[model samples]
Target: MPKEDQNNLLFTLQHDFKTKLFLSYIDIKFKAVLINSSTSWYKLASYTIEEKNSVLSKIHLHLDDFVTIYEEDHEKSYAIIKGIF
Candidate 1:
């Protein structure tokens, strides 16, 4: 599929997130992060996948995405490559 199609597919993964994800911040362009209800934040793992680079790989987050945050992780979490929605 085209890059745009793949992005739309990944955006839909938001519903796949079991936890409550909120728009913590919005960077330039379509870049953004959805933070769970907890204070913890998960940076997007990466942008390009080594191969095939499926929607799952492009975002570095599977259907059920998760991460471990430090006590004061806060906005410092720079989950890059979890590209535009």
Candidate 2:
């Protein structure tokens, strides 16, 4: 590749990465699953908006409630909800 081509490729890569990083941090939606002790369990009948602590405020939790939160399009659940803040 020529010098101009290399510079263009670098710029494109950098721009793509920056856009992805910014989108990942902004307006992210999350899903919080409630863990039950028995074999039967289900998702909550509510929406969780991660912006401005809305998800944390709307959901009521108990000491025994084993809640696991997963980011949109992610398979792994976060260990703790407070870590999101």
Estimate TM-scores for all models: 0.23, 0.32
Q: Which candidate has the top score in lDDT? A: 2
Residue 24, model 1: Cα distance from true site in angstroms: 20
Model 1, 1-85: lDDT tens per residue? 9999997885666545423233223323336564554342354445765555444445455324544444464643433234323
Report lDDT (Cα) of residue 67, candidate 1: 49
Candidate 1 TM-score to native: 0.23
lDDT for predicted candidate 2 compared with the true structure: 0.51
**What TM-score should be assigned to candidate 2?**
0.32
RMSD of 2: 17.9
Task: Assess the local accuracy of residue 72 in candidate 2 as a C-alpha lDDT between 0 and 100.
Answer: 75
Q: Give per-residue CA lDDT, model 2, range 3-75, as digits (tens).
A: 9999899678666655654566564643443333223223333454576755453555433455777767886
Pairs of colliding residues, candidate 2: none
Q: Scored by CA lDDT, what does every candidate get?
A: 0.47, 0.51
Q: Worst lDDT window (10 residues) for model 1?
A: 18-27
